[model samples]
Target: MSDVLKLEAPLGDVIRKSKLKAIKSIVSSFQPINNDKIEFKNNEHSDKNISLDKIQIVANRFITIKRLGSGGFGEVYLAKDKNQNDLLIAIKFENINTSRPQLSIEKYVFEIMYECSYIPKMFYFGIHNEYTVLAMDLLGPSVEDLLNFCGRKFSLKTICMIMEQILRGIEALHNHSLVHRDLKPDNFLFGLGMKSHIVHLIDFGLCKNYRHPLTYEHILYRTGKTLTGTARYCSLYTHHGLEQSRRDDIECLSYIIIYLAKGFLPWMSIKNSNRKKRNEKLMEIK
Candidate 1:
């Protein structure tokens, strides 16, 4: 038995070394983009003059490859880390001068939940030029994107597998005393490369600590609060202007699962130009 164990140990070591060598070779062969001549866009409408140099490289390491998407908070870009074997990363930029800044709060949440596997690995968070920047692991297409790709619906087996991971992710956040107020299909994204099947929960701009961090006591229920998340997937309690709890998160997840399976929610067609009336109609149908 001792002789057999010794042989197996050496064989395992050899296999690991071979894998490491292959990975290193692949990384070494990768061609990094030349960012010296890259042209970054500057918004002329902004009062602050954002220079071209400030928006090019972030943290003195990552180079912006291209803009991926933009929302009310800011824009997200595909960047490459020059210091880390030219590894691809996603960088979110929020204008420092914006009236409502949420990237800092998002950064704090990322720091607290860094150990959770379902959370994206935060690489860097700091000020770069006129924007507050956050760099993280580049994730693949979101569940919403996949839904469109799959002709607007997912199979039962696919939904089962996706929901299992999404539930685990929510459980992890709740265990940490946080509630993801903004739970939707767009925020749940698949991992890249070999981890394509792994689901990652993102967009913590609206997340909140639902309990006392140290004492673990839940927060007091409140009323007459403005809605904090997407109206479509939010719980009934949220629509009623009540504080969200762990149950609200689960309720939102249930709505998301139903949407994935059915390809559309009943209230999706509510298109009243007035936000208040639209929400009222949605509440009535919901």
Candidate 2:
């Protein structure tokens, strides 16, 4: 969400009464303060969906403005805050999904990387009504839109810069043991003019704090789900949900770089499994 949402996130004690017992249960299970990985695509659970019959907002001071985007979860709102001391924020408001855990996990991960220059800073997070709201810094245009305008053409220097920033963002996440399994140009944002652009890591909705063991089935190994990223940039293990690390981010970014430089993917020559075919085309890139 950016300066582009409809249902905005309100500040202060906007959280109201809901399934108190269930909320407390989840908080307790996560142990209030035992750091765990954030869930972008959380497993569906029986108690995932809950009714919000309780909760209230304290600093209820927001002015609704426009719609950013809409999807299965809910609509994002771009709004202004009279009490925000003159600041812009992107608000994400989703209906109660006590079963789903992505927002909660996103709050934690965004908070952790809030200080990283490579990532946007989050402003606030809370659960209100039958909706969970996450307020964050207003980032700009999506890289996909930018690419459409640039049209398969970019200087090698620009590609290198983008790759560097992507690396920095990935390194920041890895340093904290977080894995942004879903990475593509659309997840990145840049300034309007594109001259002075900043690549933001957004949509923590699918992020994973992968739990990898150093050793496995007779050898040192790792294990995890094989939730593939965008069809264009994902790797083999990423597609299989096997394992993810800093290197995967690099590989994915490489796809963007090649796309920008050549106006077409190297893999255009082959049409096999994205992981297999894309990997085969890697050598021809650059």
Candidate 3:
């Protein structure tokens, strides 16, 4: 068994908060990115579908190896950088014609947070044929994947270590006045190779700036809006359609920690076939 699993109590009991605070501020420059200035051109041929089998090369550099996985945004592929001695990378493609395009915002977030420890490095962002493509550092399995591998639960010490990194990641974003609207186990992935122990926050498709970049003003709280994240892990405020702030992100993280430690959540077993009714039940139970 690993030493991390041998521990009985949470890591926070041993680590000093002051030391963690110092560590969290190690990444300098918390300047927020201006959302208004960034502009992405709509692909005129966006009506055409993206066929991965036909797309061997993207942006004339990375060569697609195979699809890694997919989500509501689009598909991710394992690729190699031919110009960089076949350096492996992950490329994500979002259909340009989707009702809600998120790749542009995701790319902008990566650009602004390039120096942050918990963020993946973005290499290329542009339109490829009919899809908006983003190439970045290829990461390893998600926490969800590892949780399943570990029989759906994590040791207390392991959970503490994971939450520490996750907290840092969320702190980095919150410091920049941004909120990751979608916070779930699937979006928290492990780094690759020697950095495998490090945790990275991914899938910023639903990320939003809760405060104005220039004025540093907080966004107004409103309700009766549609939910933005995975229903199981989203916070109560989010399920109720309120504008998400940093608190919602932290609330979702708390749910994630509990689920990792307990192997399941109370709302995970809801089986109402009607999606609307099921979400209503989830909100009630959650």
Q: Write out the backbone clash pairs for model 3.
A: none
Give the winner by TM-score: 3
Q: Candidate 1 lDDT, tens digit per residue, 168-226?
A: 99999999888877788878877766666678897665567788789998888888777
lDDT of 1 at 279: 85
Candidate 1 lDDT score relative to the true structure: 0.69
For model 1, the stretches where C-alpha displacement exceeds 4 angstroms are: 1-55
Error of 1 at 237 (Å): 0.5
Q: lDDT (CA) for every model shown?
A: 0.69, 0.52, 0.70
Error of 1 at 95 (Å): 2.2
TM-score quality measure for candidate 1: 0.79
- Predicted structure 2: lDDT: 0.52
The C-alpha local distance difference test score for the whole of candidate 3 amounts to 0.70
Worst window of 10 by summed lDDT in candidate 2: 23-32
Candidates ranked, most accurate by lDDT first:
3, 1, 2
10 residues in a row with least lDDT, candidate 3: 23-32
**Per-residue lDDT for 112-190 in model 2, tens only?**
7878877766666777566777666666555554444444455555566567777788888777766665677667664
